[model samples]
Structures are given as structure tokens and as C-alpha cells.
Target: MSDRLFEHSSQGVSRGLSAGSPGSGRRLVVEADGGSRGNPGRAAYGAVVRDAESGDVLARAAERIGTATNNVAEYNGLIAGLRLARELDAAAHVEIRMDSKLVIEQMAGRWKVKHADMRRLAEQARALVPANPTWTWVPRERNKTADALLNAVLDGGPPVWEVGASASTPVAADPTGRPAEETAPAEASAPARGWGAEVGGATTLLLLRHGETERSQAKRFSGSGGEDVSLTERGRAQAAAAARSLADRLGVAAVVSSPLRRTRQTAEVVAATLGLPVEVEPGLAETAFGEWDGFTFAEVGQRWPAELQAWLADTSVAPPGGESFEQVLIRVRAARDRLIRTYGGKTVVVVTHVTPIKLLTCLALDVPARAAYRMELPPAALTEVAWFADGAASLRSFGVPAEVPEDGEPIHG
Candidate 1:
């Protein structure tokens, strides 16, 4: 959703007519609004810029953020509005109008931004403004246009645009008792500079491992060929915690999960939190452990010593009828490629198994298969990889866990 927001902003900032270019001395009025169906569910925001003197719409922006809090969505709207205003007129005196007192206060520096996500967004917004801009808190009634635009996008309608008075349209209020307005911008509004010249955009992956099952706690080899078990109560709690953390931090574009019960459940939790849906991928499933399913490592060593040794020694070696690390790497790579193509320059959460996660991480880091063995992935732990538009990859973090309550028993394997 952040990617979509950035795309819209990029187009508006990079290509549109400059306010100083046409109407050189007009004061700009920016009205913005953000909303969430579940306070953090089905989030979207809207912003519209107008010539304060003529009351003519200059440019408008809005997008549906996957899942985010009311506050986060509000901040996003503010950022979009300010960015649009900056792109529209570099020298126009701008006045921001919103119904969100929280955003007004915080951006005004009267309230401290504590959340890492909000703070990051705030910084991005501040970077666009070279000088102090006026901030105003208006009643919900006066902010209907922006509010309507937000609702329209959320309702599967078109985004806001810069509309001229001659091409004006009717404004509708949100049925849920919120003020609403739609916009139609009359001109192209892109930034003065190229959008992705120095650092090309990135597709960020938030990789997560599935939670605990009985086999996980027992230190057994559970694979896709084995019985697909659901997450335990403790695992569910861990997933919930992780969902909360991610909903707050990740402006996730989509949630993709392995086609396994455990992974599906975990992904569901996350998707619910983000107000997004889950997409299952067979390539993300765990390796087929074959004859070793549900067997302990020691048992596997005793029963299939030669196979075990061979498997550990070579990435190409398979266990009995099981898959090889190299094969796992192949499928995982394919999945990564598909994801990058499908969601380029976006942030995605991938719920998968340990081997897939490790292999994917290793692939992102340009490491050999042996690196997967060195990495230890805990149940519900998260790892992040950023893939750039120029084909470069970077590992942002690994083995990161959400702030979960100390109630669940530790997973063993």
C-alpha cells in the first residue's frame, strides 16, 4: 500500500503542472482525511489541493493502504497532501486542513511521535517542505471533500483528481456519518526530478516462519508430505502478537503464505490484522522429508546414516524420497521471482516454512546453500529482504520476533 501511495505521489509530484508555472501567486489550501474500517482495517486516505483565492481544485491524491491504524492512515493522507502541494507549487504558501487533531498536533511538533512507522512517515513528509507551513484543524463538516475521496477509494471508486470549476462534480458525504468529497485534477503532476534515478525503488519482503505444532515442539522432521497440522494454542498467541506488531509497522501490500495448514493459519492472522487477503503458493511449502517425517534427528541418523550424511554433505543430496536443499532453493527462487514481478516496489509478508525462509534469505544475501544450515529460524520469527528495481538485493534484518507475551512454551525444533 505504501508502494501504491508512493507511486501516486511520484506521478503527481513528477509530472504535474507547477503552481508557479501557471497561477504563479495563488495561496494553496490542502484538505486531507484518512479512515480505517476496524481502526486498523481496510484503511485508505484522501487529499485535495485547491487555489485558496479562486477555490479551484488544483490536484488531488488518495489510495487504499492495506491495513493501518486510524492515526497511521491519517498521517499518510497528510503526507500525500503535502507532497501534492509541494509538487504543485514550490513557492505557494500552503495551509493544511484536516479533521485529525492528532496529526495536526504531532506534525506541528507539539506532540512527540514515538512509533517507528509514524516517525518514519513524519520524516518523509517533513523532507518535502522547505519552510514552515500553516496547519489548521477544521470541523468534520468542512473537510467533506477529502473524506469523500477516501471513502470512494475504499469503496472501489477512482482516486481523487484535480478538477476545474467548469468540470465540477457533485460531492457526496460518507454514509457512515463522515464528510466526503471527490476530486478530478485537470493536469499532470509529477515531480520536477526523475522519480527513481539514484536509488531505484524496492520490493521488501517480510518473511515469517509458521508457528509451533506438536512436531515442532517434539523436535521431529515435519514436512509437506507429512500430516499438515494446525498451530497450537501457544502458536496462535504468537501469531496474534506478530500480527499486531506487523500491522503497526508494515504497510504491507499483500500477504502470501505456503499451502500448509500451519502457515495458512499464521497468514490469516496477519492478513486479518492488515485487512488484506492471503494468497497461497505451493512453492513456499516445506521440503518433503519423505521417510524421515516425524522422526527425530538422532533416529534419522541411526536408521539412515548414509543418506543423512550424504544429505548434509551435499546440497544436491536428497533424503530417501525427500527434496534436496538445491531443489528447495530452485522452487523458492521461482517463487521469489514471481513475487517480485507481481508486486514490484512493494512490501509483502510471506508466511512460509523454515527451509524456504532460510533459503530465500540466503538467496537474497547471495550466499551458498550451506548458509541455510547456519541460520536458525524460530517459530513466528521474521526476516526481511529488500529487492531493488535494478536487481540488487539487501538483507535488512533476520531472526526478528514480535513482542509476544511470555506465555507459550518454547518450540524445540
Candidate 2:
């Protein structure tokens, strides 16, 4: 494999022993695996290198990479394994074995790398490829060594090796090889952040409800299946007001929005003011209300009274041919997790609809899904939630009004 597959910066690149230098012409085997408990939560990776000839272990590496997806962790495992092999023998004929088919195929050039994060990781792994490298897909059972290492780390054991360290170095252990006191899980010694004490930095999400649509002004059910509505004049004014408010905030890293027209229009106003592009997150779109779309609550009650009652009484019940609260919760949760993973330690503005914003608020507060009904989200309102590395969330504000100037002029920060 060519070393110049990607032309990235020299920063953060690990360059090991040169080819034909010492520790050359050897054969090595690298096994790797990674996992996440909640898909994008509490992630880690493990990798082990072995002498191909004697079947003896050469090095082991594992680490807890907080808040990542399974695919990201797996790519990390591959990178760690490749790095270890390079340290042992840079010119070795390396056999890279991984349990993730996605990583394997992507690395081997058979599958395309899609996610931006995955593309970066694939590039790093490619840079570490040795001479005559062979990519192999192994079953999960055959990757037990690496899996065990990751599990041990996740279970509060010391990391086998630290990042940028050679194979011989260990981390978070004393001279006697016992885990250090500081290495204990935060919950064991420190009080939960939810109880009042602050821990590490958090990813703050500023959730902005979309501006007023015609349906919104009329108290109609405007969902994904309904007409793709544009922002009314009042909605445009509200969006402009929101944009002015957001422009004053520092460290506003990204502006994300639902794919629907109203949310996109609102997001565009904010993004343009903040000098950032709008990123669409489909999970933030309004719920599919099916046949109930574009109807008033009273109209729905008159037509599908049983369905509406079931949906209102039970979170799992769907409107006729529509999505259930439970279903929206699942998708919204996934999108929230992805945003947390992608924008950790940063502030992101999420422009979405009432249901998604309410769902996110419910999640941050650890309230029942049924509580969505109790929340009052007005048009172009803002809610703030901070998500920490340890999975604790703090609700900072809710339903803050987006104030417009009385003279109908643009409000500047």
C-alpha cells in the first residue's frame, strides 16, 4: 500500500521505525476490536500484536475513548494495532485482522468511507500500513484478545498502554501494577455531577424551535408528512431575532437543523449570522403525523378520537398510520448521541420542531417520555442543555423568547 494515499498534515501522525532499519523483515499479526455500550456512549478499543512465527504476544494496547460510535472505536482499534506493529517492525509483513467488516472493507478499498469521522480515521489507519500489508476479516470469537483488553479498560481496569507510547509502557498503574486511586471510576470517589459538582467540559446544545409556519400559526398538526411549509413573515422575523441572539454567543461551533423547510429556513438565518454552514440532521425533523397532518387537535379528536386518545394516554400508541412517541424517542435519542459524539466540548445550535426539542429536553431531564405533553415550546424559542463526558446532563434554560426589535429593524449584538 502506498503511504501517500492521503495527504494530511504531519500533525498527530505517528512515524515509527523506517523501512530496512532495525527490526525489519519480520512477520507480525495484529488483532483488533472495539465496542460501545450505548452505540455512541462509553466507547473503547483494544489491539494486540503477536509474533507470527512463535505465536507469542508482542504487545497489547487498549483505551477508553469516551462518547463514540462502534465503528469509530473499531477504526481506532485498527489504528492502534497498526501503530503497534510499526513500533515492533516497521518493514514487517503485517496481517491485520479485525472483527469489523466495515473497517476491513473500507481499508481494503472495496467499500466507500461515508462519515467524515470515519474518513479521517481510515486515513490515519492507512498511513500506518506497513510494507506488504494484508487486511483480513476475522470473526468476533477469533478477536477475543483485543476484545478482552477493551472490556477490561471499560470495566475500570488500567489501560494496557497509553497513546503515543511504545508497547512496553503502561498507564494508570503503580509500581506494583495495581490500579492507581485516581484511576477508579468517577462515581466511586466523586459525587455525581447531577447532584451539583461539575466535572469535565460539556457539549452544550442550544435547541431552537423553528419559526412560525401557517399551520403553526393556525394550531394545526404540522409534521413530516404534511405540506413542506415555508416560514411566514412573522416566522422570518422570529428567525432573524434568533439569529441576532445566537450571534452574540462565543464558541458557537456548528449550526444543525432538521431537513424540513421551516427548520431549515430558521437554521439558515442563524447559520448565516454565525458564519457557519447549516448541517441537516434528519432525526431532528418533525414526527410523521400521517393522516392527522394539517389538522387541528379538535379536528383530530372529531375524526380519530380513539386514536388520538390512545396516543395521548400511552406513549407507545401511534396516531392512525403515524409514528408513536416511543418511536420518535428512539430516533431523537440516536441523533442526540451522534451530536454529542461529534461535537463534544463544543456548542451547537440545533434548529428543529417542537416535538424533537421537547424530547431532547425530556432526555436531558431524565423525565418520562409522557412529559413531552407538559412542555410548552413556542415558535422560535430556545432551550439549552449541557451534556457531560460522564453522561450527566444539565438543563440550563427552557422556552427563552426570541425577542424582536419593536421598530422592525435588524437587531445587532
Candidate 3:
């Protein structure tokens, strides 16, 4: 029986015998678990090391990791487990069991550790156990012991341990573990972190495409260069529906819009309903189609087939005298940065045109620039993206109609 099992601290064992001590050759199994109530909210981890031969609990470690992602918490648990194992018997062969497939796969070198924070944590855990202990991914149900300990610590229960248990005789256990599936927030609404594991609330943007304009209905090119067009009557109705859908629901800190008339008109409706003023962002304007402005796709195809094909094939290709998708991305990226800086951790509603909306959606989804061509967002459709402190984005919902009710009741946007 390890003497270190009974002692406890948030950072793992506070007192322990020397490593590689007498009777330190026994194999060990380390099970670890971690979670955050709100994902990026309050977070903690728990780990338990046991004798592989006897299943006797050797040591337990847990700690509150403050605001962090679930991935970060999982890595912390692994680190704590490895540290506890080293204290008990540095030379013992250890098997690490965790429910996190990403952690296990990354540590095993089978999957790429793309996230910077996760890579750092994985490196730390590896440094502690230089030989790279056997990594195994178990289902959450199989890691009940550590899961319970984690929840206990999170619930403010003091860490306790029952060491020196009879290997063959099972004793009474205080298993108060809850399944992670039942406890964790659904992935859709949960704030996502970046590779750097951004902490704290995100700057959420409720991106809204403006209602249809005459140019849009006519299937003609409408760009910032053309005479700014207003919404049609149907477009006006769509804007009103969207405004009512979002006004009380998003809790918008500010309402921002494209400088163009169509977007401004849509923004006005939302601002008026929400009782918030509209801030014009020129960067959110439609693509500058230049000579192609007001021209139908068929007309452009017939007149400038080569140029049209080039523009379609490449994001850097612009119309005869206008901006490219790449250019739009650059300015939109800047706009996103400025907005996040101005309204960090607050929800902001952005009323803009199709190109900018698609570009922003691509950025949030972390896809290629060509992704804009693949997506179709209906007018007055609401798309959401939560930008974290570290510049990572969590795409919540996409193309949700503003005025549509799913259950016959008005839904808070």
C-alpha cells in the first residue's frame, strides 16, 4: 500500500516517499477525468492511480483549473495522474487511461496536436513520464472513479482517499460520479476555444444578412460601386421579422451594419426595435463588382467569359475594376478584429450583405476562402459566431430565418 494515497492537495500529493523506493516496482494504472461546467467556465480535473495487479487505489489527485476548455482540463488530469504516479514509484510501468480520445490520440502521436495549449500540456505530461506511458482511451463510463473525484472537487467536496484496501475484498465506495454526457453542455451552445485554449467569455457576433434588394431579386450584380439600393417591400417585411426575432433575444451590446443602403435599412429596423443605435462599418459592404455591377451572371458570362471564369476559379481574381474575395476577406478580417476589440465578451448584431456574411462565416468555420462559394445564406438569415479571446471562433447556428417560428411560438433569436 502506498503511503501517499491518504494525503491530498489541489495540486496533487503534498507529501510522498522518495521515488523508485523499495517495493516501487509494482505496475500502476492511472485513470483521469476533467470537465468544465460551462466549458470555458469553472473547470477542474481528477485522477486516481491504482495498482494494476490488485486494483488497490494508490493515490488520488485533483485541482481546480479555473476557466478553461474541456480539452485543457483533460490534459491537466493526465498531468496530475502522471505526477502522482512518479511520486509513488517513478520506475513503475504505468498505463494512462482517459476518456478524451483527442488527448490519448495526440499523446500517442497518432493524431496531430493542432491546438497550441494542448500541445504544451501534452509536452508537460510527456516530460514527467519521459518513456511515454501507454495511453488508452476508455469510454466515460469506464473512468467512473476519477470522474467522481473530479465532480466532488468541483462541487467543493474535500478530496479524500481510502488507501491500503484489501485487493481481493471490495469495500464500500463513495461513487458519486455523474456521466459527462448528462452534465456537460450540448456542443452547439457551448463556447469553443482555440488552439491556444482561450479563456473567458467570447465576443459573440450574431451575423445577419440583409433582406433582399431589387438588384438581388433581379439576379443582377450589386456591389458597393453601384447606386446603393434599398430593400423591396417583401425585403422590408423580412427585415421587420428578423428585427423582431432578434431584438430581445441576442442581448446585443451594439448593432453594426454595412454602409450600403440595403444593409443600413435592415440595420435600422433591428436597432429601432432593440432601442440600440446603428454603427456603420464600411468593411461589411458588398463586394465591389465594378464594371460588372448591375449585370446579370448570364450577361457577364457572355461578355467576359474568361474573366468571369477566372474570378470563379480564383479568390484573388476581381472583376474588371473591383475587389476580389481575398480583398474582402482582408477588410472583413480587420472589421472582425476591430469589433472584438471594441466589444469583447459581448453579443453584437451585424447587419451586412451576402459576400461579407459568407466571408465571415468562412472565417468562423476556419475553412478555405473558396468555402464562400459553397455556402448559400438566404436573405435575412441569422448566422452566429462567437470569437474567443485568442482569436478562435465558435460557429453556433447558421442561416436561421429571422421571422420563422418552429413551434408556432416566437423564438428569441
Candidate 4:
């Protein structure tokens, strides 16, 4: 059989000769694919819609769908692609392409969808397909864009794709996220100039630390491994104040937060003010403090003095049964890179905790891990970092406190 197979639907039968030909009404080409690390292990799907005439990417979507078979993930990609195309232009002609022969044949009505899950996903995909659609099967080599997106998500990166990104444009690699290597010193390269001085637009991350928790107020070691804590009343007020501050900033595309309750609560306030949904990013969670959680410095010193000293002195030393600063750096770096890739040239509010924020700031500055200790990030404070396309980062601001009004109203600014 040929490397490419095309199947035209009944509605496309009349227009098959010129389905995607020039001058057609908004012809779109959708390339989608899915992958599973263990066939039923971690899985993700990636899809991109491009303008057929210009070959420019119109929209991109990718998601990590927990554990699933490769076939399910492929169908999910098709569904996501169709949905994106429909959202772009309902009347446009959509040409759906995939590397999965099974998905292509099933979607083309050439094979039966025997599994219940497959049937449901297929139906959902079909429902979103435009009035007249074309199904095409292309070899894997032709579908690298979608594959890259899928792999990025499976590798502990965020499930986001840049809209209006070029089809041939490569996703930025994790330049500073490697666990084994030390981040390059910022001084090694030319200093970053003011905004718009970089080669391309920057991805601005507005990092907002979570509001005051009980443990935080007591100066305790509040980490992810310990009890999940909520924000205090003051914390809520601080979140609202921070939200008001962010409301004045223009062009914030989305609000993302750690899964922990304190950060989520803070993110909820900010997202509500911005009229955007809160996206949970697990990598932004605080470092796990294990047995030392909820303990003050004095207490930890009394209980496990040697361990505390070792942890304080080394980045790779983990607390008893908890994560090390090095581990936190790895995940936070992954999260930062994912955000940069997903929201290139856009602004995003990252609601997280102390360690992640400090680590991110340190990474952007290309400073050593120890620098995280020198920084002081108060609860609900906002820091800003701009990541350029060329792997350079600029630290715009650090630990700017929210201005809470005396009258209980949100202080805008």
C-alpha cells in the first residue's frame, strides 16, 4: 500500500476534486497523534490545526490523559483536533490526518471499532467533525509536530501548545532543567536588556506565592508531604489583594497553580478576577519536608540537628522521606519550560509555593541552587520573570507585596 491513504466522506464526494485546493473556504489541515509509554501506562495526545494554503499553525492542543492504551489516546487526539477545528471555523473544510492506521481506518469507516471505549471516543470525534471532512493516513515521519507535543507532555511537561505557532517551529528544549548538570551562570552570557530587546517575544511568568497558612505564620516547615493546609483568613485577603493587582496587568492569558490547597485557593481568587480558569500544575508543589514538616527551625534542629544541617548545606540532601532541593529543581524546571513552550510571548500567573518560586527565580537567573536560600519570598508576594525564545531569561521583579486595603475591598495596583 502507498504511504498515504485518503478517504473522502459522502459530503466531501462532490468537493473531493478541490477539497483543500486554493480559494476554498478556510481549508484546515489537522495533524494529530497519541502515544503510551507502556501501551497502557502514561499516555498523551497532541494535535495541531494548520491553514491549508499558508501551512501556518492556527491552534495546537495536547493533554496527558493519565493511563490509557495507544489507540484510545489517538482517538482522543482526533477528538481534540476536531474540536479545535470546529471552534476555529465551523464551516471550514477540515482534513484530518493521523499516523495511526487503526485510527485512520476506523475513522474512515473502513474498520470496525470493537472496544466500548473506542466506540465512545470515535462517536465523540465524529460528532465534532465538520460537515464534510477528509480522513488521511500519513507515515509517522510526516507527523513529527504532533509527536513532539505528545512526548513533551509524557516527559512531565505541561499539556499546552502555542496557538498561531508555525508548523515547522521547534518547541524549546529544557535548556536549564537537567538534574545532572548545573545551570549555566547568568554572567557567562551577555546581560539581558530591557523588555523587547531579546530576539523574540518573552513568556512572562508572574509568580504568586500562596497566602498565609497556619504553618507559614508559625514559621514551620510546611511541605507537600505533610498535611495539606489551607490559607488563613489573612491569606484569603492577601490573595484577593494580589488578584486585584494582577487585574490591572493586561494580557494575562491564564492562571496556573500547584495542586496544594493553599496555592489553589490563591489561584482561584486570581483566576476569578482575570476571568480565566485555574490550571493545576503538579510540578509547582512545594518540596516535601517529610518528618520535619510543621516543625520550626529550632524544633528541627533539636530533633534531627545533623539532618537539618546536611539538608541546609546541600541541595541534593532530602529530608527524612522527603524530596531534596535538587528534586524540586528538576520538577520546577520542567514546569517552567513547559509554561514557556505553551504560552510563548504571553503572560501567565503562576500560583505556587516558596520552594518552587525560589527555585524558578534562581533558574531564571542561572544562579546556583544555593541562591534559593538567599531569596526571601513572603506569602502572596508576586515575582516576575521573562523567558526569551533563545533560552535566555530575565528577572524582572522579585517579592513585590500585595497592597491590601484597610476597607476590605481589593486594592487594584
Q: In candidate 4, what are the lDDT values of residues 4-65, reduced to their tens digit?
A: 23334532211122253333378888889998999888888899888887776787776666
Q: Whole-model Cα lDDT per candidate?
A: 0.74, 0.77, 0.74, 0.78
Candidate 2 has an lDDT of 0.77
Which should have the higher lDDT, number 1 or number 2?
2
Candidate with maximal TM-score: 2
- Model 2 CA lDDT for position 200: 84
Candidate order by lDDT, highest to lowest?
Answer: 4, 2, 3, 1
TM-score of each: 0.51, 0.56, 0.52, 0.55
Task: Report the lDDT tens digits of candidate 3 across residue range 1-413.
Answer: 44542344332221223224344456788898899999787777888888787786777765555567899889878877886777567777677878888887787677898875566667667766634256667778778778877776576543322222312232225344443323433342224444545568889899999987888889899999888889987788788888888856755799999999999999999899999999998888899999999999999999999999988976656788888785686568658767876898999999998898888887776555677888888888999898775445778888887564434333454
lDDT of 1 at 4: 21
Lowest summed lDDT across 10 adjacent residues in model 1 is found at 1-10
Provide backbone clash counts, one per model: 23, 0, 0, 0
- Per residue, candidate 2 scores C-alpha lDDT tens digits across 130-199 of 6546677767766767887787767765444422223433223455544333244545432334558677
